[model samples]
Target chain A: MQFFIEVLLGGLLSGVMYSFVALGFVLIYKASGVFNFAQGAMVFAAALSFVGFQNLGLSFPLALLAAFTTMVALGILTERVVLRPLVNQPPITLFMATIGLSYVIEGLAQGFWGANVRGLELGVDDVPVQWLMDSTGIGVSSFDLFGAGVAAVLVALLALFFQYTRIGRALRAVADDHQAALSIGIPLQTIWRIVWAVAGFVALVAGLIWGARNGVSFSLTFTALKALPVLILGGFTSIPGAIVGGLIIGSTEKLAEVYLGEYVGGGIDSWFPYMMALTFLLIRPEGLFGEKHIDRV
Target chain B: MKNVIPLKKTLAAAVFSVAALSAAVGDAFAQAKEQFIGLPSYRVGAYAAGGSGLYGGWIDYMAMINERDGGVGGVKLTWEECETEYNNARGVECYERLKKKGSTGNSVFQPVSTGITYSLLDKVVADKIPMVTIGYGRTDAADGRVFPWVFPMITTYWSQATTMVKYIGAKEGGIDKLKGKKIVYLYHDSAFGKEGLTVLEKQAQKYGFSLVLLPVAHPGNEQQSQWLRIRQEKPDWVILWGWGVMNPTALKAAAKTGYPREKMVGVWWAGAEEDTVPAGDAAKGFTAAGFSVAGPNYPVIKAIQDNVYKKNKGNMEDKTRVGSVNYNRGVVHGIITVEAIRTAQAKFGKKPLSGDEMRWGFEHLDIDAKRLKDLGAEGFMPNLKITCADHEGSGLVKYQQWDGKQWKIVSDWIEPDREMVRGMIEESAAKYAKEKGITPRDCAKEG
Candidate 1:
């Protein structure tokens, strides 16, 4: 029973971390109709910048601010250079452009910060929380709990921002209809830059947490690949759906790998989540929380 | 009309200079005064930490030789590194791209990955080039009769695995103490990671120990469940056959599960500084099966420092990594390669030797302690001597423990059970030869 509880807690915490990255994809896709494939690259770039700045002798807060600013600038540049030019292209073209942008960003990140792995010290201790362990006999990593707390706070803040802010309204308008939003006076390009900037901020947070978990390296970009299944399950256009989908995928994969992976060759964690997402897709093509689109010729 | 004579004279002079330049260029090309070594390096990927140190040390040692002695026997050594990014396909592409370079073609090809080695085995054999996989590649390739072109020069994975079990036996007071012990093999889920399973299973059968197999997926980061299982099962000892991010992550998971880190031992590839440094202090007292010590105290390292770094010709961007574990492994690779070239030059004429000549040198290569002392690398590595029947001579391994900061040698050199390992190698080699329909060369018939 204690082992079961521990695995469940660990799975939930890991799910929250996945949700953090999935939220970045959800934020961009919600505002602009194009899927942002470069979210992982942005996470890698942000983490690299943070580590690089910290190595430059800056305080943690200052280094984080500098990294966040760099990500914002990157988001603005990406909007102006890549997305703005391909405004009215097909969604597939935009998706491909984002993929190309991911390569460019990855190259630029590694070019600026050499390709060596650097440890990111986020001050979150990875040791198990003593109180929780003593009380429930289930050891939960404090770092994981801290990461979950941060993710929860960020999600709440994003929810409030989308509900009350004027720019958030414009972002919604742009998501609803780009031409209609432009016709009204809500600048579609400006909304895109804002959405990208927000997504960049989310990437920064995701990068810091993931980097804190695993050392900052090029492999951090692979977290973006993990987020694809989350996006598929949660619906790319739904923020809450991303969070829920991430938790579901994360917990299910961990539970499945622990309970069932041994009967198979024991590496089911790699493909189990994707298989679950594929199964889910068969039932609902629009995803769990995605809006249904009716198309007529 | 008066100036026509001078103009014609100027034209003749220009033509003469062009002809002279072309002749000089042709002579330089024909001389073939340089030997080209192909380096399939990875500088950007999950395994970049290992790659940087390995390639950096290799380039530094070669540069040091050039700076100190102006090349081996007046023949300059040139090398071109193609980045493989630790991917098998890219590694093969790198091999193909670099094989055609240099004056007399590529002297040797070392792909540095078991998967890449497997992919390029037939290619290198067909191309008639020597492929040197120092401590990695097919374990059966140690039998040089079948794998004529492939050299697993240092130690095979089978030897390493058996040696690890031997070390465990020693720790438990005797080999008989291993009976009924639950030993877990926590390994990466790839060809390289799974290379030691057969050996471990055979050892288990012989020694009466239970073996548990746990495979970590590629770029292994999430392992909460795996470690939890280890915690529950409480294996007597865990042998980690992992690389790259998997090493540190495994250590972290061990710490999280409150498992004793000292009970776990990593393979040679998982013993580098990057493997443990990321885990911070939790990696203290972590043991690993190591072939070489990590430090700058070796004479060869000092020579490299004096010749390469002092002269600003060293390839490592980070000067501090000159004496790191993986870097030293790279230096050892460079030393063995240079020694092979020297051996070939001694046998053949003193000019640039071809790949076949290099193969001969590898077959007959002998690096005794005296040779190592002359090369300024005494006590840096075990004395190695390759023969026709055995490419991997005396698989010597040692245990190193990480004491929060660096790896320290904790045990004397231990030789793997050669009788058992050789039987397996010959059997596997015969299987490979039959599969390929290639005739095995008799050792007695060879020169």
Candidate 2:
């Protein structure tokens, strides 16, 4: 029972991190209608920028401000330069362009930063904060608790923004139907720029916290891929689904690997999540929260 | 009025210039049919930081050979780079793409990845292409009798792991003193990580120490829980077998866990500028097993400056970090490949030779004192000799510690626990051969 509690907490913490990255994916997909394959690369690029600014010996707060500013500019530039021309192209073309965008971003990041892993300081000591109950122990990291708090705050802020703001109303209009939204005074292009900028800021925050836990490297990009099934399990267009899906996927992956791996020679964590997500897809084609769509083929 | 020629005249002049340039290029191409070496660099992938420096060093050296010495044996050598992105499948594609150049002479391969090395072992050997896996490869493949074309040059995981145990034994006073000492093996869960486990297990049995295996996930970013468990268990020594981001991250976790860095040891693969550069002050006193001695004043490096750089032959600018471990490995890789070619040149006489001939050269390779002096690698590494059975050349390693600034070698070159190594290699190799249905060759009968 003690082991189960520990593993469950471990899963939830990891799930929160996954949800953070998945949130970036959900934002871009909801607004741009393109699966941003470059989200991992964005994570890497954002982390590299944050680390680079920090390495310049700037104050941590100043470095963070500069990194966020840079990410906003980068988000705007990506929309203007890379996605603007392909606005009317087929969805496949848009998807392929994002793949190419991932490559270009990775290459450029390496060119600027060179290929070295960097450690991030999250302004909190990484020491474990232990808790004991009746001679039984349930220890958790202060850093992890801090991460969960940050995730909750960010999600609440996003929810409030989407529910009340004028731009939020326009974004919802676009998500319902781009053509119908364009029929009104809501400019599709401006809405996209806003959406991308928001997603990029989220990526920057995710990168900072993730880099704080694990040293940042080019391999950080692979984490975006790990968040793929999260999109499937949670509806790609639903923000709340992203968090719930991430937690479920993350917790289940840990539990399966810990309890079931011993019987099958280990290393089931890599494939088990995908299998579970596939089963969910078969059962709920529109995803856990996705609205069912009728295609006029 | 005085400005420009007519459009027709300008076009005519441009065509004539183009014709002349093509004629000159043709003559140059005729004069020297270039021998091409394919370099599959992992400069933008998982291990790109380590890959970039080594690839830069190697490409610079090859450029030097062409500019100063007019290539090896008077056939100018040129190389083209293919980014593998550190994927084994992509590396195989790069090999196929570069293997077809007509002027391809005894080419050498340095994949810098063990997974790719294992994937290419059979293909390159069958294709007769020489693979130079510096510092890491399959341990059993060191027996050239079974694997004739593959060369793991200086140090292998088995040898380094064995040597690390030896160092620990010495540090703890004696092997018997380690009977009850708890040694935790904190490793990345990959082929690269699992490679040294067999050797450590064998040493544990021999030395009577308790071994606790802790397997971390790939890319190995999250380890707070593992470290907490380690703190709880209080292992005496921690052996880190990790790569890329895992190294510095693990060190930081150790620091957070309040574990002394002096008691931790990393393998040669984990020892580099990239690993320590991240965890700056916290990683002080951490030790790793290094196979080669890389320094500023080595003879070969000076020779490179004199023979290759001074004449503007190689890319020997501030970019060429010769003293770094990865760069040294690259330089040694170049020396071994060139020596094997030279050895083949002695037997097959200078002209482009076949892969089997190169294989013969690798098996009967002898790099003695005179050869080292000739090759400009005297103090960098000890003389190496590869034979039918002895594929690793020599099971020697040195201990290095990070002083928050740079790596300083602390121990003299120590031989691996050979008796333990031999038994493990033979048993594992036999098991591998049986699984693959490969019969062991009787060397005495073959001669």
Candidate 3:
């Protein structure tokens, strides 16, 4: 029972991290109706910039500020250059463009900061919490727990921003109907840039936490693929859905690998989440929190 | 206007002379006696760290020879590095692109990747080019009769596995002491990672230890569940056959589960500084099997530093990596390649040897201790002799432990259980040969 509880907790913490990356995708998709494939590359670029800044001996806070600024600039540039040019085009064309954007971003990141693994110390201790382990007989990584807390705070801040701010209202209007929002003088282009900038911030947070957990490398670019299942589970446009979807995928995959993987030759953690998402797709095609749509022919 | 016409005429004459000079130089390059060594290098991708050091050392050593001695026996040695990015498909493309590049053709080819080696084995055999995989590749390639064109050279995975089990047996007092002892094989889920399982399984049967197999997927980062299982099962010892990011991640997982670092050992691929450095202090006392010495104190390294680095002709991005483990392995590879070329030159009269001649040189190659000293790499590598029957030469593996900073040699050179490993190698090689409809080469008939 104790071992089971530890596995469950571990899964939940990891799932939260997955949600953090998925949130970036949700923010972009909700505002623009475009599936941003370059979210992973953005995460990588942000982390690389942060680490690169730290390497220059800048203070942590300053380096972080610089990285965030860089991410925001990148977001604005991406919107103006890649997204704006391809606006009103087929969603598939936009998706393909984002995929191309991912490659460009990945190449630029590696080119700027040579493709080598660099350790990112967030001052979060990775050692198991002694008190928790002693009381529960299940070791839990403090770093993971701290990451979850940080993720929650970021999510809350995002939720508040989306609900209260004028730009947030404009973003929602644009998301509801881009043509309608444009007609109402909402400045659709500016709304897209703002959303993309917000998405970039989310990518930065996700990158720092994930990079701290696993040393920053090109591999972080692929970790975003794990969020695809989270997006499917949570709805691509629902922020809260992303979080819930990530938790479901994370926790269930852990439990499945621990209890059931041994019988099936193990290593089910790699594909188990996708299987869960596939099953969920059959039951709820619109996703757990995604908006349902009907088209009249 | 008159001065301008004269100046234009002079400029035209100068341009004509420069063009003629370049044409003559091009003709000289065509006629220059040189051997073209094909290097399928990877400077990018998941395994870039290892690739950089390995290919860096190789390029540096070859360049050092050219800079110092004007090339081996006054015959210039030239090489072209074709980037593979560690992808097998890209490696094949590199091989095909560089195979026929030189004046005579590619003298030798080293893919430096097991997957690439497997892909190129048939192609190299058809081309009669000797492919040196060194410490990693098909273990069955050790059987020269079956794999005539391929040479694993120093050691193969089977040998390394057997040597590791022997070291474990010695650590536990005796082979009989391993009886009922539980050992887990945590390996990367790939053909390269799974190569040593059969040998370990055979050892488990011979010695009565229970063996458990666990496979870690590629780019293995999150292994919480895998570690949780280890925590539950309480395996006595763990043997890791991982590469790239899997190495440090496994060490981290082991540390998280409170597993003893001393109780776990990694294969040579998992033993580099990059593998353990990321895990920080937790990686201390982690043992790994190694075939070559670590550090830049070797005579050959000094020669490279003085002759190549000092001249600003070194190929590595980071010069400090000159004596690192992977770099040294690359130097050893360079040594083997140069020695083979020299041997071929001695037998076939010095001018650029063909791919077939290089294969013959690899077959009859011998690098004794005296020869190693002469090559400025004394005590760096074990004395090796490749023959018609044995392509692996010396199946020796030594154990090293990471002491927070650098690897310290913990055990003397330990020889593998040759008889046991040889039997398995021959069986597998014969099975492969029969499947491929290859007629086994008659070693006795070969010179």
Candidate 1 TM-score restricted to chain A: 0.98
Q: Rank the candidates by DockQ, best first.
A: 1, 3, 2
Q: Candidate 3 falls in which docking quality class?
A: acceptable
Better of 2 and 3 by TM-score: 3
Q: B415, model 1: CA deviation in Å?
A: 1.1
**Higher-DockQ candidate of 1 and 3:** 1
lDDT of 1 by residue, A1-297 (tens): 888877788888888889999999999888887888889999999999999999899999999999999999999999999999998999999999999999999889988888777777777778888988889888889888898889889989998888899988888888888889999998888888888999999999999988877778887888887788888999988888888898898888888888998999997889999999999999998889998988787
Which 10-residue window in model 3 chain A sums to the lowest lDDT? A111-120
- DockQ metric, candidate 2: 0.30
> Cα deviation of B98 in candidate 2 (Å)?
2.7
- Which regions of candidate 1 deviate over 4 angstroms? B1-31
What is the C-alpha local distance difference test score of candidate 2?
Answer: 0.78
CA lDDT of each prediction against the hidden true structure:
0.88, 0.78, 0.87
Sorting all predicted structures by lDDT, with the top scorer first, yields 1, 3, 2
Where is model 3 chain B poorest over a 10-residue stretch in terms of lDDT?
B26-35
